[model samples]
Target: MNKPECSRLYKVATKHVCALLLCFCLSLSGLYRVSAQDIELKNPSLETKVLSSMLPDGWKRFEQSPDVQPGACGITQSPYAGNTYIGMMASPDWSERIVQELVTPLQANKTYTVSFKLAYPPEYFSSSVCSGSFAIYGANELTEKGEILWKSPAIMHQDWKPYTAVFSTTKAYKYFITGPYMDTICHNAYRAVLLDDFSPYMREVPQIIVQARNSCKGEQTGSATVRVKAGQPPYRYRWEPGNFSDSIVKNLEKGTYKVTVTGANGAAATTFVAIGENELTADVTSSAPICHGDTNGIIKLNISGGVSPYAFSIDGGVSYQDEPLFEHLKAGNYDIEVKDGFNCILNVNNFTITEPEPMEITAANASAVSCSSVKNGSVELLVTGGVSPYIYEISGQSRGYDNVVSGLDAGDYIYRVYDQHNCYVEGETVINKEWRDCAVFMPNAFSPNGDGMNDIFRAKVHDAVTEFRMAVYGRWGQLIFESRNPNVGWDGTERGSGLPAGSYLWVVTYTDSKLQEIQQKGTLVLVR
Candidate 1:
């Protein structure tokens, strides 16, 4: 807290403020240089008390003379942020301003935010103080009044206060100025305010806030949202791969995504967001159908992981149910799926409903009935399929492990075969009467000449008749030929001697299917 040997108190009284401005301008270039962006100001807090030789060290006058406040100005309050402060005011005609050549020029068409501390102390200025607004501007030169970047409302605060201004530059700016707000209708009386502790000088970069959601296992169901904060309006957005230009992106898998957001003034920022992984899995236990060709199967499913409120589908998403139990499924292979609240899906493809093999039986080698009225037919049965060791039955009669059934009548017989598991199949077979009606016949005339035509006389017995006999007699009533075989023939011979040609009498007798004897007599001619 050492006192300065000379302050601006004596210089302002003698009106030597021009001498002070000339000294600061000579030192402005020697103070510092900016390497990157216009990110900071020189002597930002006005931290100087050499009022006799300098006008706020790095600052120069743009309008009416401004005061680098000295002890005589009567500000009892300590500096709001630094060792010293500066004061500016509006005269009867124009407002006073202080400008500084920025270390580097700001990029044109880029948005920026500037902040400083301001206060109004009546005695801080030279005796005249009426309420007035504060203003900030961007300039190309230190002498000209640049375009107004921002203007505060009438500031009447007694204590130190903070103010912020955000604006887009029309051109690349070399100098920045701060002054009291003034226009045509400005206050004619003097109005003054104190400024101290400039925050910084830099283009505004928007804040990027990312909100990401997890994705489904083996599916693309995640999401992310990019929000721009503290930047210009009508922001433009972009994403990688798809080149999507929206705030929110959806249907993303487990991966990191990059997004760039650009403000209206062409200031942009890039950020990365990540969508995590979620495992959706399911296990199913099923019951087989009760019997072959039955549809009474059931499945119970248990699910784990992922979001809640799950749904299940058995018939390939055609229908869905909240419960995990499924019923009445046919015997076949199946693929079951479950969906979670986030629409994540899990599928189990190895599910089956099985039953015993169907019963198969073949009825073959059937014996025909001997007579039209008898039940003497039989059939051999072959059983396969179904479980092992099958039991056979015919006409509702259980057979003791016998595949053959005798004494089958001429009708349709219903048969069934039972597996060891009590699974049965019913089938049918028919027994037909093969032989019944028969009659014996003989030709009357046959030539005995050895010309290979009509040389023998025999009875045609259809073979359905048994116990056959045939005989022939000459005109003298003597036996000419006799035979007990139905197929045997008679020639015109007597005792191995050739006989004369004459008419002969023949008789045939045979037994029918009912064991009844049949007799028949006829006359035949023989040629010698």
Candidate 2:
């Protein structure tokens, strides 16, 4: 309760506080000393000396404290008398040594900054003391084996203040040395130079953090979020399944997806998220087949009942995210497989494709014509057999000439017919009689003179000619006349036109009255 007691208690508390403070300072000092030792210095000293002379062995001196100009009062006396000072003196000419000590062992592709403190004594030079310079060396010989990393012309004043000159190490040097290369042209003789707090050049590597997700929702309401540490802001974020935007993924499908993040500083990071499933069924469809050659028709398959965005594949091929429609398919069996929103694939049953058949050519009789003679004969052919709307080929030839022919011809020939399916049948009969001259044969020849004689070339035997084609060529092998009807023919003229004075070859071939190719060839002389 007395003043003396209160004062004694306060003193005791002060003593304890002082002891704790002392202990804290000692601990901090020990840590600082350890950290300083790790900074390998070439010239570790706390004395004022020319940086060139302080350099270790193999180092050449560049410059020292050489006198510049004389003056009564200089910057050496007042504000600049602290730990930092600047002076104008010739460099130790040891530019080589400086470089060797500071730039010989730096790594490639690394970024680093150089830093050091400088001060100028106002008493050493006139108030006009303007600037100073320094150099670095990596080799003792200082040949072209090193480079200049930094230079400065710091404005000098009458203050002992700290200044820093920064530089970066190049890939050519693995180690380096640094010191002052002075050019002090002062008007005072008391100029002083001091340097301290020189930081060892070092590079800082950038840090990256990448994140990813496994799956996401598959419907309109489904979504996934991805985050990454890509350095600075204004980062570019992009999603694989959609356009690039500043968005956490939304309404995703059941499948794998990727997200890329790029920062403004050219740094990049990536993340992934997968959407959930929502569907189960798939729909398949195909165009109607027209013929065996209609293989390029579109075949489409749409999936549903499982997920929104589904994966698709055909016959175990590479999987694609978009709905697929195949083209250029042949007439055969096919299988299409589709994956649901849950990454589940369902293989469809085998489906067959059939194309329509072409027209067919058949014969009503098996009869042959004699050689080198005109015969008054009738032939029959059936074209309405096999697949409906069929195309046929009819051919016939003599016994010796096994090359079956089509159309009507004056010769002994056998007949053969083919249907739309490329299937054929043969029929034959022997003729023992010879014909006379210029015989007007039925369904064999027609004179298209336009005088009501034979205006049309046609096969008019009796039975229906299913598939037939008649063509007439000029003497120059050019098709001058053609007729598909059995009642049409070429007369003495070229397609009812006046004939020139020349010999033209005429050929008639078909399955005449018989279901075989009857080929006939003859020369018709035209008189003007």
Candidate 3:
């Protein structure tokens, strides 16, 4: 061979020897590349601290060394992939790179797709870091960086960024190389670009398919079967909204359902299916009760959609009827369900049944009876709530047309006030007989004959009395004598005319210091 030919062969031979020696040294140091086919790209990330000159298994280096990092050269960036990733740096001298041999060669006339991620910062060292780009190349041997296959633009981001590359080849290549790319030589600077998680040669998994049956208007008859088209065996299905794992969903309502399908390769795909039904709705109107404790309240439903002959239920579907107007209802809240002929139901909640504001007697001012007598109490009521034009009644007593009733005995009495709507409220009040300390005395049987004593009938009083009145009635209920002053006396006669004497009824009414009106009545004998 000529000198030029011999020199080329010698250079090529030198490269092979260096690669073999380096590989042998790496094998001894437990740092050699594992064949791609043997690992199937296993442990794409490193588990232990690795040197800057070392590459993890399933990777190799040509002229320049790369790093399996996050622990070396002052780099602490978290792995973008599994645990550790590659870092390629471009310096003022040359761009750094890493290479690997392929088990399956890149075929001619076919396109291949792959993806990788790059990052620039958060803990940088060993060089003055700056923005940089990367490139991928196809070669025939570990000693060469052959034809450029794909190139990325400048990577300036501080966080991880992904790039997907698709390339077609005319020559079948046997190796893959990735490196930081430099258009021109940098001056006194270094750019550190991270590379990670190159996609394996995998065909895209197909999308999920679903077959479904819609629900009837109100029936839960919907069903579905989710199919994972074209993937590895042993797939797991995860359904959203209910978190079910079965491949088939049954008895569904009217809503959207989502599912995620995962294969053994750890690839996942998600899709959704909706089950539709005929719409059914209603508008409810409730009427308040006319009288308290009356069950005449009504609730009406004006339903809009679905089939005719609708049945309504206010008891949570415990019972249903065809009538839309429900009467004889009490005051309370209700949840109603309207069912169509097809048994489809629409729920309307918070249908309130109300009554009138209760008839309340705001105040009842009662004057207690006196211990000296029984029927000397009085009560006055201030009424509210029920309709106007209210009439008052006291049990077994006359209240006339007013709310104030007097002459009440010391007892528990039921008082009722009726409104114009005939809606009445009854309440019980107690009139207690109180002992008065006032010095007032009256005789039950006294003779009114002209004598030294007991001739005139009068009451003796001392302690604070505000007002007093006295009246005398004959045996036939005739008002024979009346007086407005306590000091006045009755001589058992009418006006100034003398009359026949007999047993007479005397009534006395007085207002005490406590402003209580008290009445007392008894019979006194008028001896002739």
Number of the predicted model whose TM-score against the real structure is largest: 1
Give a tens-digit lDDT track for model 2, residues 451-499: 7754554433433243455566668987766666655655545545665
C-alpha lDDT score of every prediction, in listed order: 0.73, 0.45, 0.70
lDDT of 3 at 170: 73
Write model 1 residue lDDT over 193-299, tens digit each, in one string.
Answer: 78888865554656678898889876688999987755655789999866889999999988888998876645577788888877877777888775678788899
Give the alpha carbon lDDT tens digit for every residue of 1-528 in model 3.
422343244345455554664576445544333232211232334332433344565566564555557764566778776777877676657556776666466655444446778887533454466676788788887666588888887777867888886555678777777787766544556766788776654222324689876776766877779986555446788988888898898888878999887765555667889988757777778887888777989999889876677888988999989899899898888898888765777888887887777799988888776544345577888888867778888885546568888777677888888887878777889887766655557887657667768888887653345579889898889899888887688987787887686788999888865668888888887777
lDDT of 3: 0.70
Return the top candidate by lDDT. Answer: 1
Off-target runs (Cα >4 Å) in candidate 3 are: 1-18, 21-39, 46-54, 61-65, 68-85, 89-99, 102-119, 122-192, 195-207, 211-222, 274-528
Order of candidates by lDDT, top first?
1, 3, 2
Q: Alpha carbon lDDT of residue 204, candidate 2?
A: 24
Looking at model 2, residue 189 earns an lDDT score of: 26
Query: Model 3 RMSD to the real structure?
Result: 17.6
TM-score of each: 0.38, 0.32, 0.32
